[model samples]
Structures are given as C-alpha cells and as structure tokens.
Target: MVLVEDALLLAASAFIVTSFVGLFRVVRGPTMPDRVIAINVVGSNVVIVIALLAAAVGEPGALDIALVYALLNFLLSVAISKFTVERGGVL
Candidate 1:
C-alpha cells in the first residue's frame, strides 16, 4: 500500500515537473503578459509543492514558509502585471 507521505511526495514531484514545463512559456512567450502569467503559474506551483513537502515531513514551520512564499508570489504577479500595463502590454 502506498503511504500518505509517499503519495504527497509523488504529487509534489508531479507539480515540480509541471512548474518546469511552465518555465518554457516564460522563456519563449510571444508577449510580456504571457510571460508574466507563466511566471505566476510557476510560482503558484512552487507554493503548492512547498506545502505538500511540509505535510509529508510533518513540519508546521514549513507551512508558514509556504504561506510567505504564496504571499510573495501574489505580490510579484501584481507587480509584473502593473509593469506590463505601463509598458503597453494588455492586461
């Protein structure tokens, strides 16, 4: 039987892989908005991965780190969107 910790790790791995794939969009996006959205997606995925790893390890402190990361990701996305808008990229 698959243990809970093992399952969480597997899910985290899958998210990490998907996040890497998202990086390709950031690298080759045709527009600044596209790149910004891709970066946000990857950042969100990282937060999820961190949370999952924290759960797997039974570390509550890591959850706090994940929360901080999520807040930072939100701020980054907003900042990037504002910059893109100022630069004439559509929201």
Candidate 2:
C-alpha cells in the first residue's frame, strides 16, 4: 500500500508539473482556443490531483467533489466552445 501511495504521489506530481506548463499557454496563447485548451488542461490536472488526495487521505467526500468538478469542467468546456464559435470570430 505504501508503494502504491508513493507511485500515486509521483504521478500526481508529474501531472502538476505538466499543468504548470500548460498554464504558460494560458497567458501567452496566440489564440483564444489555445488559451481555452490550456484552461482545460488545468481543469483536468485539478481533477487528477483531487482524486489522488481523496485516495491518499481516504476521504470519500473528496472523491465526490472530484467527480462533480470533472462534470462541471466538461460542461463548462462545451459551453465555452459554443460561445466562442457563436461570437464574431474570437475575442
């Protein structure tokens, strides 16, 4: 179990680092879609980290929250994409 936890932590750390890299794209994006992609990456990382924490701490509520966050992320992404498409060619 300890080994499993260690692996999970390592995986979480890697994802977090990737997320930070994605964060740069959010600020330096050349296009609106690029920024949106970066934001989505961050949201995915959040979901992963939350799930890791829930497992590490044995908190079921955290898992529920993670699930909710994942759903919200997907819904928000779709809404943003639709709005961007409807808008007069990307703000």
lDDT agreement with native, every candidate: 0.92, 0.88
Q: Candidate 2 on 37-61: residue-level lDDT in tens?
A: 8889999999999899788766878
Backbone clashes (count) for model 2: 0
Which pairs of residues have clashing backbones in candidate 2?
none
Q: For model 1, how does the per-residue alpha-carbon lDDT over 1-91 read when each residue is reduced to its tens digit? A: 3599999999999999999999999999988888988999999999999999999988989999999999999999999898878888784
Q: Which ten residues in a row have the lowest lDDT in candidate 1?
A: 82-91
Candidate 1 regions with alpha-carbon error over 4 angstroms: none
TM-score between candidate 1 and the true structure: 0.94
Q: Highest lDDT, which number?
A: 1
